[model samples]
Target: MPSEIKLVNVPALGKTAGYSHLAEVRGGRTIYLSGQIAVDAQGQSVGTGDFTAQARQVFENLRLGLESVGLTFNAVVKLTVFLTDMQYLPQFRAVRDEFVNTAQPPASSLVQVAALVRPELLIEVEAIAAAP
Candidate 1:
């Protein structure tokens, strides 16, 4: 929706709920964001041991990063989410939904890991976006 990025969900699979199966990009400058953790401007952890709060902070951090480059969440074509616990997914989706467009969600993947750089950190998110 931010330009030529297109969301594609094949009929062969079940209809996607929160994310598109594929993102088709015609042409644009691709931006790859570094993994964003739930840290504030002061580099302080925003929500220690709280999955939902950490997720919200991560999205906010990502938003700021995108803004710095003259892009918005709408320009995002792909996202990768990392979590320490798999059970936090439903809660993460709830928070993520607030930031991302459901009608044209980006290609996404969620992975559960043993731990992050800090034990208190619960989640991390990174994105790939395209802009003209």
Candidate 2:
């Protein structure tokens, strides 16, 4: 393991799921990625109701974003997923499993929201990473 797991408390925010209110990983290289949507390099939506297509695009964007910082998906210690439709989660997860290491899934959170910057976009993902 590159870092120790930390439990962060935010009394004001209340409790979450199996995860802590927040997580802290000891340092190496840290990367903060902006939320990635289903948009392609040209900023066009890749998938409409097709969660798999959108998920693939999201991971591709994430991979490129990570490469820009000299890291990979394996370096990710945390991930936050925001979705306009919660019903698509199973589809997202199935596709997501193909991109990430199953043995060591990162600490993660999934949030369902009503909308995003664009109405056609259904999902957004962001990540935090630590690596040596």
lDDT for 126 (candidate 2): 94
Candidate 2 CA-lDDT value: 0.78
Error of 2 at 24 (Å): 5.6
Model 1 Cα lDDT, one tens digit per residue, 19-130: 9999988877999999999999999999887888899999999999999999989999999999888899899999999999988799999899998988789898999999
Candidate 2 segments whose C-alpha is farther than 4 A from its true place: 1-24
Candidate 1 residue-wise lDDT at 35: 91
Best by lDDT: 1
* Per-residue lDDT of candidate 2, residues 41-108 (tens digit): 78889988787898889989999998988877777777899988889877888877877766556778
> What's model 1's overall lDDT?
0.91
